[model samples]
Target: MSLPAPLDQIAVRRAVEAALAEDLGRAGDITSAATIPGSAAARVVIAARQPGRLAGLQLAAAAFQALDPAISFEPEVEDGARLGPGDVIARIVGPARAVLSAERTALNFLGHLSGVATETARYADLIAHTRARICCTRKTTPGLRIFEKYAVRCGGGSNHRFGLDDAILIKDNHIAVAGGIEAALRGAKASAGHLVKIEIEVDTLDQLDRVIREGADVVLLDNMPPPILREAVMRIGGRMLAEASGNVSLDTVAAIAETGVDLISVGRITHSAATLDLGLDIALG
Candidate 1:
């Protein structure tokens, strides 16, 4: 599937470059030196060791290509496809030393990201009956936010702000520092350009009421109980979008979605997702 137009492909490529740099450092893979010769050629299959969703194929290919320009990647399965154990997701032919060098880094990107997508897809499936949609938050790996959020989309979850510049989010800190919710709301609204919509995070119904009175475009109902979230949704009454966030786990997402909120932002999707099981098996021609 094509990535969203709003996504900057250059930025994504740069991120992959940065990651490759971190792994390669000044000298390229030193470990591959003692084992594999420079002119060696090999064919490898990236296989899924367990059944789950797949994502980040192109990014992984980019990582390998960065290591060896001669590397060729043939994706047998597309991103966002559900796979079973023993499935060959990709076939790669390249310099043996370069393939060995890029193996772990490439698998690291795909495994962790595809794991997030798989986990998010499970939550999305749980809330499929509800009007609420699963969304991801800014709580991502420091530099890997784009990749993580992209994986979220692959899993059927929507993305929140990619960064602070793209949207105005007045959280509790902003309210405390700005004096009050109304003050923060007014300040954000006044300073924001016509295109910027402000979303304020509120922990209580009382705070929610105040923001509603001040006119917020979106309210992130943080850590609210199911009853309170439902009440907040009714209070807002379609005037603004109600977003349920905090403590959102697979077990609780369905209940949160049942509260009639427009969105559910889960942080754990990217922050703590386990890497999916995958491996690259070299084949002899």
Candidate 2:
């Protein structure tokens, strides 16, 4: 698959700058300033502790550059690449104190985003043979939704609507407040622009039938079992995109995919993924 575009350079710079400021504090890296000579130079390598996919090399590079504009960060492999234990992701050469000061912030972005990518890849790989594609939900870290979603793409997964503004998603609550699916769909369709697609969540075959009859752009099959999902897809019959979600895990994902839904949306790929273990160690010549 073609790689997703790299993050906007301005966004990268701003995030790392904020992180470096927060980490530096008023006193700065006092220990490094005191112990490491200003003239001292060091080389470091970021190595993986376990096997997984890579993401956020750009942010890591930005972190170092934020501290020292002259820092040289050479990425050995791009984001979305697979990693093995002891795999050297990138090499950094710069003043010793600046390198030490930026290490944690750089690793923080790298590890969290890599975790998101790796977890997504695990789900994507399982459903690769099926017609369904893995996708991530808005259940992402508050300010890091874009980054996490980008990481999902890095793992060979697809992206859902980026925000409430991206499309009209009439959920269970919307239906309840709007009185019924038909009313909700009617209101959404009336308000939506020519380009906006409307998706609605349904939990039962009856609701799916109503949504299909009423006409929607996509149907979210919320928490339905494999059999129910299969029936829902059959009911859809190519009229609307069918998406399944709720409490999905590795053991059950393959089965869910076999049900032939168009997409499987998982929230944990961002909110609950374990951070991939990566470390910046001094490179010895």
Candidate 3:
């Protein structure tokens, strides 16, 4: 499969700038400045300390380039490429002080984003046998939603709504406040433009029937077990798309996919993914 496009360069650069500012502060890497001569130059390799998928190579490169325009940042692999322990991701050669100052911020972006990609790949691989496509929810970091979503795509999963305005997804509370699913869907359909598709969440097969009757474009099946999900999919019968959500984990996702749902939305890939272990070491010359 073709990989998704990288994030906008301007946005990535802005994020890297902010991260570098946060790390540098007013004093600005006093340790490196005190030890390394301003004229000193070194070559370093950013290597993976554990096996995982790669993401955010551009962001890491941008971090170093922002710090020192003369630095040469060369990536060995693409963002979605799988990696093994001790694999060199990229090579950086520049003034030692600038490289050391940019090191932590670059690795932070790389490790965190690669972690999200790695987790997404795991979920995508588990459900590869079925028609269900792995998706990521909007539960992402505050300022990093776009970047995190990009990471999800890099790991072979699809993105959900990018924000509240992207689509109308009526959840349980919306239904509760709007009186019922029918009313909520009606309001959404009426308010949304002709191009906008309406999706509603339902907790049971009865609600599924109501959604089908009300002509929702998609139905989110919340917390349904595999058997119940199978029954729901059978009832749906391709009239509308079915999306499975809630408590999704690697152990349970395969069963959910086998039930024939069209989408499985998981929140943990971004919210709870463990950072991939990566380290940058100065190459001996």
Candidate 4:
């Protein structure tokens, strides 16, 4: 399926504005103002310094437009497209000061989000031979969860619960607080609406059995090794969706996918992915 359109423009603009405000501060771009003339116009190219999948192209453009509405920002490739080293992603032409001022903020969003997409793509590609799908957990940057999850989709991965309100996910802590797995699932079923699917986390095969008997919509197999995951999948017997999570990495995801789990959720895709290498270089006239 096609990925959803870029995030809400108004929200994007608000985020860009907040980033610019934090960056410019009360002094503004002193270096650019001191070194460049306000009327000077220049063209700059946004290029990837290393190879990776792309994301956040629209956010980068929004940063420039927020700074200078007249700035001409054009993207050569769309988000989710792969890039090689030295590939030009976009070109910007505008007042030299505006271009220089917006450079860091634009790249901050673009590179970081592209990193998320790239990491997600790596995980998705590693497990393509199986029926399992890669998904991202809620371990995302505090204010950027929506943007990061969108990047996951751009990379051919799926998103788990968007927020606590989106679904009923009974984790270990919830189980302990509510008494046990059966209690948590029963409470969730009693409290949640019929439309909301109930998913409970289980660490052992026994817990998995109880979850199945409790009639949950989905069961999360947390921290299960491939062998246990295989057994859990067999024991589940198509009764409910099975999700495997915890310690998921490029090195081990393929093995986990081979266990026949329905979904594999990785937290590091958004939480720990390194920013992709991208740079804004002034184009020679």
Candidate 5:
């Protein structure tokens, strides 16, 4: 899918800049500085070594462009495109030293986020024939939530709240702090502004029953097994939006979706996703 028009260039720039800053902090690329001629230009192809969905090509381009304004990127595949091994996703041509310097940082963002989108796409495809929607959780890299969540959308999955401030999520901890589930849910609904939605997490059937009785806007069923989840869906009976979360993985995601919950929020799709296999190869020009 095309990135949202009015793409957050500012946020994307900040992320690319921060990554460059981290890599070039103080010392700079000492090895490239020492070995590569400053004015030399090179052509490099970003090739996928494994099959997966692509995301963040623009960010990768931005990462290189920030380092070398004269650098040019020719994208052969857009974000959300399915790819096979050895696909040339993009070509970067610029000062050889700059290309080498920016390579890791560009691929760092590209590979990691693409991996998330790819994994999310797999889950999204698995549940596509069903009504369940794939979503992500608060378990995201700190400060990278916007990009990560954007990648989720690219994978055909929806996003949960960007953070705690965006909505009132009365989790188990909140319930503890507020004394009980009822108190927490009630307080959340009562104090939340009219525009805000109140969702609560329930770890047991009893908690789900309680939330259903009180009529929560959404109920997150945490760590419930398939049987329990199915039962919870029946118990809730559309009283609220039913969400199944906690330890969701590709192996069990289909089963979880079969339980008939409305949403599945998987943390591993973000926090623990492995970077997709990608590499920059210097092409003969």
Candidate 6:
């Protein structure tokens, strides 16, 4: 039940507030308002309906707190905790209206982030014995990249660059536009700050040779099979960080890892992970 470092409270607060706004638009929980008395209170337990790695607890708590400052959200598990079926994630007690109003928003955060974490864990665990690490790419859900990346870490996976601004990854298009790999490398090197590393993607070992000569911090071996990947790693010989991208899946990740590349970047972990099923049930006091 290890916990990752706490998410930025400011970020969590802003995201939760915005989500709550979207859900409680205009009239603001009219269903709850119409049915529940002003003084009515209720207790509930949010439980996992399937196995997963937990994440986004802070956002879940913030969702309820935004509506009712006095709401009690006693968490039974922390982010990064591996959950089992029927496990109670948290206990909530508050104004019945606030509880009902915040339920969907809270579970939305929990389920989505937990799903990302759970999927990442599946890949990470498979390649645990190998030197390679599982990494999530920029193909993340819009407006939810930070949360999803954090969830990846909670699942024992590493993160790729957070965005285009964080690092320079010269893709095939960039090379084509810049005239060639050498030209792209020259341009990126000239423009980059001292702290920034330049990474260039290459499809074939010929391009990799040019990159090795041109010099870069990391080389992305795009879509190469395990045999080619192993050869590329040998060619690089620890000169630049070796990363494999494209066509990576649970079935083939182990083979990719055994090739000795430093990172295996998978986009599906964030873009296509299924929502972990979770539900809030009103508790009888």
TM-score attained by model 6: 0.97
Task: For model 4, state the Cα shift of residue 151 in Å.
Answer: 1.0
Worst 10 residues of 3 by lDDT: 1-10
* Pairs that collide, model 4: none
**Candidate 2 minimal-lDDT segment of 10 residues:** 141-150
lDDT for residue 227 in candidate 1, whole number 0-100 = 95
Q: Give the runs in model 6 whose Cα sits over 4 Å from its true position.
A: none
Clashes of each: 0, 0, 0, 0, 0, 0
Decoy 5 TM-score against native: 0.93
> Estimated TM-score per prediction?
0.93, 0.99, 0.98, 0.97, 0.93, 0.97
Q: Report, for every candidate in turn, its global Cα lDDT versus the true structure.
A: 0.89, 0.94, 0.94, 0.93, 0.89, 0.94
Local accuracy of candidate 6 as per-residue lDDT tens digits, 1-285 = 256688899999999999999998998999989999999999999999999999899999999999999899999988898999999999999999999999999999999999999999999999989999899999998889999999999888988999999999999999889999989999999999999989999999999999999999999999999999999999999999999999799999999999999999999999999999999999985
- Superposed model 1: Cα runs more than 4 Å off: 1-9
Error of 2 at 257 (Å): 0.4
Off by over 4 Å in 3: none
Residue 141 lDDT (model 2): 88
lDDT tens digits, residue span 153-218, model 1: 888889899998999999999899999998999899889999998999999999998998999889
lDDT for position 91 in model 1: 96
How big is the positional error of residue 221 in model 4, measured in Å on the Cα after superposition? Answer: 0.3
Let me know the TM-score candidate 2 reaches against the reference structure. Answer: 0.99
